[model samples]
Target: MRIVDVCAFYTPHGGGVRTYVEQKLRIGPQLGHEIVILAPGDEDGVVERGPNARIVTLKSPRFPLDRKYGYFASAEQLHGALDALAPDFVEATSPWRSAGLVADWAGAAPRSLVMHADPLSAFAYRWFGQVFSRRTIDWQFSVYWEHLRRHSRRFDHVVCANSDLSRRLAEGGVPRTVTLPMGVEPGRFSPLNRDPALRARLLAACDLPESASLLLGCGRLSPEKRWPMVIDAVNAAGQQSPIGLVMFGEGRERRTILKHIAGNPHVRLFEPERDRETFARILASPDGLIHGCEAETYCMAAAEARASGTPVIVPDGGGAADHAGDGAGMTYAACDPAAAARAIATVLRSPRRQPQEARTITQHFAELFALYEDTRARVRMAA
Candidate 1:
């Protein structure tokens, strides 16, 4: 089986979607599938080849108004590429302009749209912020919804990352929806590979004491992430326990988040380490992972942390619960700093240091991959 993946960006220049695609490309070959990637160009348009896949890049001019709008490559260009590759299945990771083109070009071929995030949640960022008025946000969301309504009917299947997203799509009258949770690479993010020396070095670099309790939050620093609530919780918690919060990842909310944490000696926010090994070590070394976001479809960071034997504390309402599974972690109410702090405190105070049953979570990924393969095979037979 040959699959063509259409995404806004590819690895080295992308985020969660790219990581998920790369994981599939790496593991899918073992299950008898060849994968190819189509992504927007950076610097100069050029083809870059990977071990199990080949990437085709198209030059996307960065518009002054919206940098992301460049993902809208010409339909002819996209169709030309699809004509050349003629993949057995085409998977679009976003509902962008390029994705619509792919669906049109795919014809009767199996085409799937994977919803990684809630479109409404994204709409809040794109238009409802201080930069744009509430009216603008409403208009943009309406336009987005209409666009999705039209193009959604074109795909053979719609894959949602969580039940929340699936519910939202169902409410919007989308057909053939399936919930598929994201996966984590246990080998790359295991606790067994933690380096004590690296931990000490990292703590020292952050001006944190070696004995201080460390709580970690890893994700984009944005409004949707609700990082301010995390900071507030840490501040409130510091009044009781000797806890220090360390956050990884950079985003648009950096200045606001830093200002909120300013003058608080117990909080430190920095960009993530370039190496995955170092990042995994940090997660393993932390006392617990703090997740403040309520809109997560499936948080890869939380999954990785749990797989690293570190307990996670997330809100009760989102897809994070699906990853928490069987007391491997705890869940708190969304936006409740006190509840979050209490959960983290409980995990820290507990004497039990039993290893988490992360193998079960890894098995979930294997099952998802099996399902994907099965679906792909059925699609091929029908085609």
Candidate 2:
């Protein structure tokens, strides 16, 4: 089978989207498939991956707000490539204007819209939460929901990373919305890699002893991440007992997040870890993963923390909450610092839970390809 993915978020320095696409390309050939990625780049070029995979880049202008990424503007170039490649299956992984570019293409290939993020929850709600209520925001964004429903109705399937997103889209009348949870890299993180010395050193960095509790906050430090609330919760919890938060991430909101963490000695933000082995050790070393974001489509960092045998403290709602309470996890009401602080203290005092089985990215691709194959067959039969 031959499949093509039209993705605009696959940038050189992108986060989750880039990681997911790279893993799919790596595993496509092993599943007896040829995979092609049609993406916007600095120039038109092609990079051949092992044998059955390649990336076709088209010259494009920088995206608004973030210059690190680009958008698809030349419909002719994108459609021309799809015409030439003639893939059996196609996927548009971004919900931006580029998605319409893919949807407009006259390819006979059955297509899917695999969501990269939940704009309504991640952006709209976070941007206006301080000023408006949830019902008011939903009413204001009714046009956007209708827009999504209109476009997604054309695709064979609307793939979501979590049930919350799938349910929302389905409720908004998007036909064939399917939930397929993403998977973690196998052997990349484990409780066995937990280092006592590293934990002690991290605690000491915050002027605390080995007995101090350490919490890990891993994600892009954007406005939507709600890092300020996490910092406040940690500070409040630290007042009662020795506690420190080590956040690992780098993003456009670094300065803002740093400002929010200012005057708080127990919370520190660090650059994203590059080496997988080193990051795995650091992840497993933390006592618990404390997160404040309540609008994630699927929180991979929380999954990694649980897979590492570390307890978790997440908001009461969102994708991350789905994995809570399975082992050593606790959920507090969203946007409540006092509740978060109490939850943190409870998790620290609770008995340690053994690491649960982590799903592998390879398995994810295998299942995804099977679904693509089935969709292709169904589309051909209908034609």
Cα TM-score of candidate 2: 0.96
TM-scores across all candidates? 0.84, 0.96
For candidate 2, write residues 115-172 as lDDT tens digits: 8788888888878877999779988998887778788878888988888788878877
lDDT of 1 by residue, 279-358 (tens): 87887887778888777778888888878878888887557766666666888876688998888888777643545555
RMSD in Å for all candidates: 4.0, 1.4
What TM-score should be assigned to candidate 1? 0.84
Model 2 backbone overlap count? 0
lDDT of 1: 0.71
Best-fitting candidate, scored by TM-score: 2
Candidate 1 Cα deviation (angstroms), residue 178 = 1.6
| Model 2 CA lDDT for position 101 | 84
Model 1 CA deviation exceeding 4 Å by range? 42-52, 63-69, 123-143, 194-211, 351-383
